[model samples]
Target: MTQDAKIHHHVPDAAPPPPSSRWSHAVEAAGWLYVTGQLPTDPDRPEAALPPGIAEQAELCFANLARILAHAGYGFGDTVFVRIYLKEFARDFRAFNAVYARYFPDDGPLPSRTTVGVAALGRDALAEVDLVCFRQSGG
Candidate 1:
């Protein structure tokens, strides 16, 4: 099979990839989907205001990621790894976990994750996240 057949770029229908942006929302190849970092920007209203506070920002990040996953035939259960960035780690870490756990709750398999404090983020977003999702060769 050709490489294009092996790797599928999943651009969420809900949010068209930015006209001149430099990334795909997700790319699937070799049973894995590598998702791009997601911000809390509204898909329908890219210019809308963002909610203030870590909890809300974290929730939005996940929400945005979930949409991309679905478009690629993946879900939280398919996530194998994640990376999180926060403008204020010390102040938002605990609150961010409280919100994050809802997706990978105690009953679900929590993906490996690393969170770091960042000096800044685009649009000054408080948090941003990205993930890798996998599906077994046949499953």
Candidate 2:
């Protein structure tokens, strides 16, 4: 018998999160939640302004990511894969690692990840992160 799969969309209500011209914010399929790249975006602020630095931006990005995950009924432990895009890899890698380690200490399965250097991102943010998480069945 083929099992039926359910899909869910997670959107936080406090602010209107912008959608990528290419995809939805998050899509769940076959028990897996796929989240789109999240940037340090303050919807209330003007897009021309940039956040202070990599670390601050990373934290905000993660906070946005976490909120999306939560809305989809998942958490950090459910993440099985992560991809990070960095506009200034050489200058920001170290600081990024410091913040990253705090989130995935002990390495434990440590969601397979790929960090790539990029020329730019939406709003010219320094870093952005995208993740995939598996929801525990019946949890």
Candidate 3:
């Protein structure tokens, strides 16, 4: 008989709660972690108002992503890829990049990324992000 790899559906207490019951914040299997899209929603007070401006909003999104990654024993260093959704791609792209560069420094390893303009996002947020991470062990 063969054994099957176990899967984990995680809703980290330190990360923002999922907006709906239909999804988890992250799902893990094998050596990979798939982090659901993170909005600027406050993890400690999810009902709070979102930050204003592209820089603040993007900062919040990265903060939220950081919390989710840490909860899974991962960090930006372990991130392999990222996908960002922006409400105003042309206007916010440069500002967002400024904030993003802070997390993935030029001297450090950076994850592959895709950023696209989106018509909408949950909570009417200006930005949202998701991550994909890989590790050698299933920790």
Candidate 4:
């Protein structure tokens, strides 16, 4: 198959991918969905002010990620990995995890994760998160 036939780009109507030609919100290839890092900006209103606190910012990031996942016909349960970037890692790690735990309950499968300290993120966001999900072909 050609590259176009093997890959699919996902862009939800509610949340346009960042204004750039270089990236998409999510891309599906060989039964895997890779979601780009999502920041705290509101998906419904990208221009609005970002959520102020780490917990709240983390919540928005997950919400944005969820939209991309669902748009590509995947869900949190399908996620196999996650990567988080925090502007204030030492101060906000616990609070960010508190909000993140809600999406991945202890009773259910939890994706492998890697979180790191970053000097900055787009929109001055306190947190940003990305996801990788396995999409069974022919689903």
Candidate 5:
């Protein structure tokens, strides 16, 4: 069987920015979807101001991640890993955890995660997150 036969592949329906940068943003290969850094961009308005607090920003970040997973035919249950970048880890960690708990209650097979303080983020976002998920197959 060909590689494609061995494993189905899927790319998200979202498109990259028109003024292409060196980054590809996201890519899917061999049933795994790798999402790039997702900021707290409002679904209704991409340029909308991210809420001015860490808790709100974290929630929005998750919201953005959910959209990407949904578009790629996956869900939070399929997430295998995550990486988070915080502009102020010390000040925001508590609030971040509070918001995180709501989405990841019961520690449901928590995906591997890494979080670190960052000097900056795109558009002054306070927090950003990315994820990797395995798409379920129906035979």
Candidate 6:
């Protein structure tokens, strides 16, 4: 962040964003916010158990991302791009898509997206997601 630039650091009140962590949940600069990848683990309670199945895990990942965007005064409607990671692509891709559509509906401007299959994720989470957003003026 520079002195003449308006930058915002966020820690999503809804999810709380991993207490005292070294990384920021989201950072805003020049009307854009770069959100960090969100795992299915509960940021509000690190010790809490994770949700089972890809559908639930995928939903949680989006929920966590939503909180980060909301904290920074943005939303999915502001999103320009999204990236998703899946641990079991063969088994869970369809289920993940179903959950993903609920949050990112086709009725609106769909953000450009990429979904990658991964061997594993932090805390053994089945999925993770991150976003890049452009905040519209007065929105």
Q: Which candidate gets the maximum lDDT versus the true structure? A: 1
Query: What's the candidate order when arranged by decreasing lDDT?
Result: 1, 4, 3, 6, 2, 5
Error of 5 at 129 (Å): 0.2
What residue runs in model 2 are displaced by over 4 Å at the alpha carbon?
1-8, 14-22, 43-48
lDDT of 1 by residue, 47-133 (tens): 778899899989888888888888888889998999999999999999999999999998878899999999998778999899998
Task: Write one digit per residue (lDDT tens) for candidate 3, span 1-139.
Answer: 1134645556555454655646677876677889888888777888889988989989888888887787777888888999999998999999999999999999998899999999998889999999999887734
List runs of model 4 lying over 4 Å from the truth: 1-4
**In candidate 1, which residue pairs get closer than 3 Å at backbone N, Cα or C atoms, i.e. clash?**
none
State each candidate's clash count: 0, 0, 0, 0, 0, 0
lDDT of 3: 0.83
Per-residue lDDT tens digits of candidate 5, residues 3-106? 35433223233333325444444566667778877787676676567789998889888887776677666778888888999999899988998887777676
lDDT tens readout by residue for model 2, 2-63: 24665657474312455545455688877788988888876445353668799999987787
Better model by lDDT: candidate 1 vs candidate 2: 1
Model 4 lDDT tens row, 79-126 = 999999999999999998899889998999899999999998888989
Q: Give per-model TM-scores.
A: 0.89, 0.85, 0.88, 0.89, 0.81, 0.87
CA lDDT, every model vs. true structure: 0.84, 0.80, 0.83, 0.84, 0.74, 0.82
- Find the 10 residues in a row with the least total lDDT in model 4: 1-10
Taking all chains together, the TM-score of candidate 6 against the true structure is 0.87
lDDT, residue 123, candidate 5: 76
State, as a TM-score between 0 and 1, how close model 3 is to the true structure.
0.88
Candidate 5 regions exceeding 4 Å error are 1-25
Q: Tell me model 1's lDDT, rounded to 2 decimals.
A: 0.84
Cα RMSD of predicted structure 3: 2.5
